[model samples]
Target: MPLFVSMTAGGPPDQVTRRAAHPVARKGINDSPSKVIPTNNFYGNLMLGNQNQGVWTHPYSLRWVKGTGNSSSWGFGVSHIERSQFAYGPGNPNKYFIAPLGITSIILSAQELSNSTALTTDSLEAFSVNANLAVSAQSGPLVTFPLVQGMGFFTGVYLGATALIQTDVFFRTLSGPWTLGTSLKYKVLLEDGRTWLFYVHSSQGYVNPQFILRSNTTIQGPSGFRGSIQVAKLPEGQSNAESWYDWAAGVYPVTGATFGTFNNGSASYTLSWQKGGDTGKTLIMWALPHHIQSFNGGVGAAATDVQLYTTTKGQATLVASDQWVMVEKLVTDMGFTPWTPQNRSVTTLPEKAIVAINSVASSELNQDFAPQTNLDSMYFSGKGLAKFAAILIAVNDLARNPGLAAAGLSKLKTAFNNFVQNTQKSPLVYDQIFKGVISTAGYSDPGADFGNTYYNDHHFHYGYFVYTAAVIAHLDPSWLNQGTNLQWVQTLVQDFASPVADERFPFSRAFDWFHGHSWAKGLFESADGKDQESTSEDAFASYALKLWGRVIGDAALEARGDLMLAIQARTFQNYFLMDSSNKIQPASFIENKVTGILFENKVDHATYFSADIECIQGIHMIPIMPPSTLIRSKAFVTEEWNKYFSNGRVDSIPGGWRGILYANLAIINPKASYDFFAQPNFDPSWLDGGASRTWYLAYAAALGGCT
Candidate 1:
């Protein structure tokens, strides 16, 4: 669990010591100690739950850019690479890896003093204030610090002020030659409850290694507090030797070329600046009572690296080259490389995929199939066939090892017998299309369509069985060719994938050449003409036929399958996927830029139950038979991700759609796909309970170059 920081409280309880690093959790799922663990999770869990975790917490991103035009000179000397200014947090991950900015200075406000000016700048130049460089003060998020005792800003000021002033400016886009500066003015209530006007300056330039901070009060009167300055360096290690500093005397002008200090007290606390030593990193001079507070949060010396100053109330301005390519430069500078699972291999997949499959299969095999008493024969036969097929596929994939193979083959043989019992024409054939009963069960109405509606899902129902038969045949041709009573599996395949003809099932009975797509309306009569609502399953049916043909050495059938694929690809893009209004689909069906249930004359832009649009889109991609370029050329993947998922909205998505989106993403953004799949808490619930987690993961891992 991540340690929660209560920004509301002044600081962590007194007993809690600031540790240099937090304890790490167990090794990540599929992670090896030798591999460099990614600090950011890449928002992989975004679809599992509503809460943001994983890579979603990363607030900044970098992209590489090549210089062009006038900006060609950018990134000339400094590694010949330029980077964009860092982006602010996206806010939902709820955890922050503290990266401290440079020195922090605060002025406690005792009363509301708005009219005063607040100037903030980030630069590496020496501390000389130019009067002309002032911007208006605006109230925004508060920047605060703790009131620890002995801290120069604390014990010295003793003003008991829990709040401080901070100001910042941010530019979403930055080009070359930019300055980083932030300055602010605000009133702070002292421990004595006296209001004092304070000025705070923080500045750092892109090329400079040093940033400066100056804090001083302007309130002057007989009862006014005298000016004082303190310097604090957030030491990197356990050593706090330079944690705080107090300027013993009052403020004054320097007279010599050398660094000096002024004092109203007897003892002199000198200030110096140069190149050789630690003292050269900073210098200070001020009068008594004017306290200076500067402590390195032990993270970094840069202003942006600090995390302890969130309580300071101020505006923050970040200025840098906003060039898009700069993000790539930044990513490179930060040592970020696209992560590939170390276990990936040509014959195997990442361990996580293997484990997920085995685990899911174990649970599935151990449980009995849910009763289908409420559904008609069509629903039972169709849904059960798909489930059975998936299980068989898993068993076969795991059968390479002798021990595992025996167990898997036994299960496969038993399932094959059971399958023959339910589907074969001899001995038992009650669930076949001709014997299927139109019983009153749930939403199933087999007779509603042309001959067997099953809610217009006949093709979907049969396609699964065909795909499974192909797998079995590939594994054991003898079982298909001469095994007792197993010729029936081929008969089932004919019922779905046979060439268009009479005597048996109509040639490609489900597919309509006129529409250039398969229609699932088995026997349903409709004003909109025969309609195939699930294009995903339609394509899937064709894919199954193609594979089965390949296994059986039927070149004619394979060619037919290819023809169907070519037609589906062309027609689906023209009629199903669209943007602007077209007569082929209803105007109402254009939401989210994807086509839904398309009919001869009607289009609904939704599936049977109106599920997530991406779910339907994902289905269309699942057959995994089309050339990857077909999917890429339409630009469907990028559009879908950018619309609903890029900003972490995927946290709301659940089940099969999550798998579909991520797996599809694997084709293009493999690193991102791996990021989500590799997350330790990756939940199987993100899969449609019917999906094979193992296969989905393995497919994605393979595409991403996982072995």
Candidate 2:
């Protein structure tokens, strides 16, 4: 069988013919190490060189300090930030919150590992990064560290190599070589008033690899030892932390490999360790705030006192179990019709709404839709097509105007055909090196279309196109089998949200199931790790996927999208959308309402393009569709508007941002939003290129604004 298989008969060509060269070259990425290819993950910096940025695992961050900074040895540098260590922007309510880095608690290294040793990743998976430390260019790795997110232990597996542990924070006391099951445990007290637990386990059984405290900051292990070393930090003032840790210490030597599964409205993921020592022992893992909120009833009792604070996602509770099942209500109720908070479809509009929708649809359809949509940037082009598609849907479904809908659909099909034929200004190419589809615009200019060729915001850029195709297919089902139309759209879907990991594309490249959200930053090394800006666009992409799946009759894809949206809703509410009642974010900063850009190490209340308050808030409200009501609750919208855009503040904001805010206001105050968009002399400048007045009116009216 060929490596790249198309979902439809006339789908994308083979990789050999469609492959194009990309500008940003990958470094140190192992060739076909494993079946999985993770482009945007927490451990992406491992592909970069020695000055690698931090890879966050939440509650803890690890980096390769290649004989630089405080440490003079090549090792996995570990650090954890306390709540007091955070730096905040100046204000009564701070604009941003950042966790401090470079506080190296310890460096877990082997004596053979040094600056000259080659650091390479062997296998890259959705949840883990396997880092290898080789003695020289041609020699095998002396140690392999499987670094996983939310793992309680920083485990290192050795191949008869000596262990050398050093800490920048001087060690104050070293206690215990006591045996707990098949492991030897030691408690180390650091000068910085932090306690750390270290355990050593040998697979050969009962062989003691004596570790001696050479100095205040260094510990040396016996030469030619074969086993694994595990390290974990104890939360301050938690008396039962050690007891809980000890209960699961027998299985600590066995590192876990994570895998996820989703079905119906429920999703479950498991971290199963390769069996070692006591077969009955359970694994110890940390659960993020969202995970704890959604965990099923099958798990063991959680260590309530043994909790650690994550950098941005609040507290992580210690759960000594292996599996977590998250049940969420999927958005199966939404479809082609205009959806309302009551979950009812709007078949007929009031006379005023019909008049307003028809007038705007006529004006929008008369314009040259091709020039507006057939642009070089996928982001802008997709927005253009989606804009017209929304207008057509509103005219046909709500206004009951078939003639105008027919005219609009014709123009929309012609505009969408340009992309299906791959004749756009900047054509897409199957990037064989990265194993995904990308825009050629970035090959010439790295920053073009916000680095689409480099894989930044694939979900945002491709989502609009998917939504447009879904609308077209729903309005005219024959379009599904028309000249590779379905196949072309499927290629884009597979590129961003492939259901399985295969040679053609990585599984869920944009969405991170473990994080309960998606990461927008791609193939870039940042000290803060992968970050996402527009939570609305992120949710919109999943919404697009859900509708596209429904229209094409793919139940599995629809279910996947439904589950993703559910997870995104839970996580966005917990981390991104800060309601007054939200306890995850800081009290001083939760007043911002929405986290502008949520990075692994920080959360900034600002956008990359503009620092304006409307841009920051309205970016999360663009293309407000059905899922918008599900994710952005009425309470959240009311709180956000009252905080930022209420009291006549929204009127002062210029450009398309104003329209986005008003459209979002429909979630809580539908009548006011409908009145604003349906005004006699509505300003065209207020509408974004991706938005249309017809759809906003329809959206508000469907939500009970048709007075």
Question: Could you say which candidate leads in TM-score?
Answer: 2
lDDT of 2 at 260: 48
In model 1, the Cα lDDT at residue 368 comes to: 43
Candidate 2, lDDT over the whole model: 0.81
Please identify model 1 stretches exceeding 4 Å from their true place.
1-406, 423-455, 482-486, 579-591, 611-634, 705-707
Candidate 1 at 685: error in angstroms? Answer: 2.2
Q: List the residue pairs that clash in candidate 2.
A: none
Segments of candidate 2 deviating more than 4 angstroms: 1-11, 14-17, 31-36, 49-51, 204-206, 250-280, 300-305
Least well predicted 10-residue stretch by lDDT in candidate 1: 323-332
Q: 635-662 in candidate 2: lDDT tens per residue?
A: 8999999998998999999999899999
RMSD of 1: 29.3
TM-score of each: 0.44, 0.95
What lDDT does each candidate get? 0.35, 0.81
